[model samples]
Target: MHIKTRLTILNFLEFFSWGAWLLSAGAYMSTTLGFTGVQIGSVYATLGIASIFMPPVIGIIADRWIPAEKLFGISHLLLAGLFVVLTSMTSFNSFYMVTFLVALVYMPTLALSNSISYYNLEKEGLDSVVTFPPIRVWGTVGFIIAAWLVDVLGLKVSHEQFYLAAAASVLLGGYSFSLPLIPIVKNTSRTLFQRFGLDAFVLFKNKNLAIFLVFSVLLGAALQITNIWGVPFLNDFSISYKDSFVVKHAVFLMSLSQVSEVLFILAIPFFLKRFGIKIVVLISMFAWVFRFGFFGVGSPEGMGLLFLITSMIIYGMAFDFYVISGSLYVDKMSDAKVRSSAQGLFMMMVNGFGAVLGAYISGFVVDYYTANNGIKDWASIWFICAVYALIIGVLFALVFRYKHTGEENLVIKK
Candidate 1:
């Protein structure tokens, strides 16, 4: 098979494992397992907790000892076993422990998968910028398809979603061994701190970079709110709109956000070139405002449903703009020597610290709005989220300062 085809399948199954359960897991925990908001939030926070340090640690192992492909395969095989273990746990402490372990093994694979792709693409003499986006987009397609399958097969509310994810992880893990081997680069000059990418922390002295990373954490918090609550929020409408398609196929409807994501990614180059990074990121912030506000006002019928659909569509801008543009800005601002580490730091801020903040705080907000009888006030919850996003946008516009040069370019370097 062609390398491109092989990489496409690799990317597909990579995200397929995540898509099988991420959005619906909250609903399952809430309605089936009888977990409280705090418990569920803590469970989802495991991703952020593991993402904070594991990727860099894993990167060190791949850098010094093992080939990237070998490590990638091992991570997934481990993840498959963990997912299987997840199916058998029902207690809060046991479930949280297993989920955190799964996150530890699984999160690093995200970086590993990208590393594997870049290695193979370069080996085949393909321009990664040109060939990889099309291949990578299939990951989004895989996510959408997985979500739809869960919904259609009636697995969204059952442990069976974990089974589906485990099956995909097993296949991906086995297939990874067949990919081109990534040779480990032995660099003897680097210090222990440098190996862990801790050297990038020196960039904190730069006022602009410091401010931008601070906001990255704040915006990162917004990233997972919908993922954790979106399905359950829609499922709540089952009481009012029993026959509505939105209620019955909530996961399918939520998959539209990923579809929007694929489309918006194509537009990022143009937006970055024309508006510059600051304005582009600000646009993303406001998009989040709309993303939540629309959900606050939307229902499963009439104009409310339109608001819901609009929220899903706006998710593309809210997500892709900040993440892509912020990464580009970090690349431009940092020195070339620490550039890769700088990017790692950026991910740590947004996906790690930011995600943890969002999970706990959002959980508190959700529980605060719930009555003693278990009735949740979703509108209040969503409006609070919208307000938080708006505050971040306005504060970012006023406090963060950057002069945009028209010469900025978006380059994806491995």
Candidate 2:
């Protein structure tokens, strides 16, 4: 295979593993395990919890000890084993434990994939700005493929999805070994017992960065709310409207969000350059408001379809701007020695601490609003999320001031 083709396949398999379960797991919990909102939150929180320490630590090891490619391979191989175990789990505690273990192996792959891609791109003499987005977009396509497979193959909310995910992960794990070796270099000149990628901690010292990280945690809370509840929400509509198309194809329908993510990502350079990162991100924040609020008010019926479409469209901004743009912003500002660590730090806030906190709390809120018979109060749940996102958006606008530089300005309009 051509190097780009090899890398593209790598991207596809990497996200396909996630696509198998991430979006559809809500329905599995709600319909299969009969878990409450808090229970769901706890499960999703495992991703956040693992992300907090795992990514940076593993990154440090990759930088200083083992080849990153080897570590990446090992992580996915571990996840493949865990996914098999997860398929056998029938209880919440057992399942949560297994999922947590799976997360420790899986979540960091997100960061690792980027690291690998960045290294490869630079090696090939391609600008990440121009090349990475196209490659990264395939990951979303992989996600869509996974969702379709689960839906069409009738694996929704079943162990089969995990089996499929396991197979892909194993394939990717072995394939990782074929890529270029990422060497680990020891730094004998360093001090004792400092945290892995600790330079990210200094971001706390910058006022704007402190606020950004703070809001990142808060917004990160809003990020997973839909994933934990949306499928089940659509499924609930199935209970009353059994023949509704939404129920029949809920996972496939939700995949639209991922599909939309590609287009939104393409728009990022324009938004970033034209308006600057601050406004671009703020627009993304408000986009989250629309994302959740539409769900609160929308239905499978006529104009509700518009609302649903709007929500999906806005999701591109809500997700891409904060994550991709935020990463780039950090890159533009940080020095080379600590750049990787800084990126890991931003992820720790958004995906690690933020996601964990969101999942745990959302579970409580979602379950609390759910009635005695166990039907989720999706409207109320979405409403709460909409409000949370709105508040965060408002606060972000008030804080974190920055004027776009000339170089960044050129990048955007180009």
Candidate 3:
């Protein structure tokens, strides 16, 4: 097979492993395991908690010693076993422990997967500039497919979702071994801190990077709000919009965001090159406003449905322009030696600290509005979320300063 095809398959299965349970896990925990609201939030926060340090630590190892592909494979291999264990856990504490371990083993794979792809792509003499976006889009497709399969197959409330994800994890783990081997040539001249990737944290010493990272964490919380709450938000619509097919098939409806993701992912290079980081990021922040506002105001039926659909469309820009572009920005800002670690640190901020903050706060907002029979005043909840995004956008525009000289000039694209 072509190297692109191999990497594409790798990307697909990698996301499939997460998609099989990511969006649906809440329903299973609530309905099946009888977890409380706090328990459920904590369980999902495991991803954020693990993401905080795992990526940088493993990234340091990959950069200094072990090949990224090998580490990627081993993480997934262990993840497969852990997912299997997750299917058998009956209590909240046990499930939390196992899930945290699963997240620890799994979160770092995100950056590792990207590094492995970049390493292999460069070796093949293919331009990641042109090759990677298309290949990575399949990962979104795999995520959507998993959401559809679990929902359509009646596995959302069962342990089978974890099993399905584990099977994919097993396949991905084994397949990762076949990826191109990345070298592990450590720089012996580096100090101990540099050797362990503590050096990547130095970017925080720069004023602009410091400002960017702080805002990245704040915006990242917005991303987490949607991912953690979107499924339930839509499902709640089935109460009033009972006859609406969109509400009935909320998972598939939300998958439209992923479909939109593919398009925006392709367009990222174009927009970032044309508008530069500030404008592109502003686009994302503003898009988040609409993303949450539409959710807050729109109903599953009536003309309000238009807002929901539009929100899904905006999600592509919201996610692709912000998270994806932000990663590229981190790549541009950091030196080559700290490349992997920088990516890990970026992941740590957005997926880790940001995600934890979003999960807890959103949980509070949800509980605040929740009433008898579990019905929630979603509009008020979403309104507050939208306000938060708006605040971030305004703050980013006013406080986060940068001059655009074109992305081609950046270290990442070059």
RMSD of 1: 2.8
Arranged by TM-score with the best first, the candidates are 3, 2, 1
**What tens digits encode model 1's per-residue C-alpha lDDT throughout 46-112?**
9888878876667556655777778888889998999999998899999999999998988777766
Question: In model 3, where is the ten-residue run with the lowest total lDDT?
Answer: 405-414
Candidate 1: list runs displaced more than 4 Å: 1-4, 118-132, 195-197, 202-207, 327-343, 409-414
Instruction: List the global CA lDDT of all models.
Output: 0.83, 0.80, 0.84
| Candidate 2 worst ten-residue window by lDDT | 405-414
Which 10 successive residues of model 1 have the least lDDT summed?
A: 405-414
Ordered from best to worst lDDT, the candidate numbers read 3, 1, 2
Question: Residue by residue across 33-95, what tens digits does model 2's lDDT show?
Answer: 877777788999998998898877776777667777888898889889999999989899998
lDDT of 1: 0.83
lDDT (10s digit) by residue, model 3, range 1-414: 988899899999999899899888887887689776667778878888988899999989888888888899988999999999999998988999999999899989888877777777878887665677788889988998998998898787789899999999999989888887788756774687765667888888777778888988898889888777787777777676777877667777777888899899899878877888889999999999999999988777777889989999999999888887887777767776777788889899988898888878877778889887777899999899999999999999998878887645455321
> In model 2, what is the error at residue 156, expressed in angstroms?
1.0
lDDT of 3 at 23: 82
The predicted structure with the larger TM-score, 2 or 3, is 3
Q: How accurate is candidate 3 locally (lDDT)?
A: 0.84
